[model samples]
Target: MIARLARQLGKEERDLQVLEAVLEHQPIGITRIARETDIDEHKARYSLRMLENDGLIEPTPDGAVATDDVEERVREINDGLDDLIDQMESLKDLDG
Candidate 1:
């Protein structure tokens, strides 16, 4: 399960960063997410919309929250990333 997310995250680093930002700050607003993650607001908004479509996050009264599935997926992905960071970081800037 995590392997799949890791693979997807490798291809979608920006999306993963947005996800990571959301994971770090629940019920955070889009503007805050862009600032905290160092992502452009447009990109963050697009990512947020996509994440919602993917069922990774959902809207909250104050902002947004990661779905239970997303938290679990993130945990699994983190546990398996010991050796993959350097490789992924190298390609993080590439647009998918």
Candidate 2:
């Protein structure tokens, strides 16, 4: 279970990396996103699709751009991660 959670978190991290690249460079393409984030082009493309589906980003003739909802979604994600961290801390306390 822990390993699965770790993998999920890693994927989330990678997706966020791709999102950051797009946020920094609006109208950015998958190839440039891969280069900027050091992620595989396929992986970046996958992340872009995921983000678009999540309404965090949109694709244009130029490239992918962050949506207005990006900031709100990021805040929710951060809050969820904080909650996960707290749960993990509680788990650690179980051994004490």
TM-score: model 2 vs. ground truth: 0.90
lDDT score for residue 1 of model 2: 87
lDDT of 2 by residue, 1-96 (tens): 889988998988998998999999999999999999999999999999988988999999999999988899999989998999999899988953
RMSD of 2: 1.6
Model 2, 19: alpha-carbon shift in Å? 0.7
Best by TM-score: 2
In model 1, where do residues sit more than 4 Å from their true spots?
A: 1-11, 75-96
Model 1 Cα lDDT, one tens digit per residue, 1-96: 669977777546887888888888988888999899888899889889988887889999999899978867766767767557776787778887
| Candidate 1 structure, TM-score to reference | 0.63
Q: What is the Å distance of residue 23 in model 2 from its true position?
A: 0.5
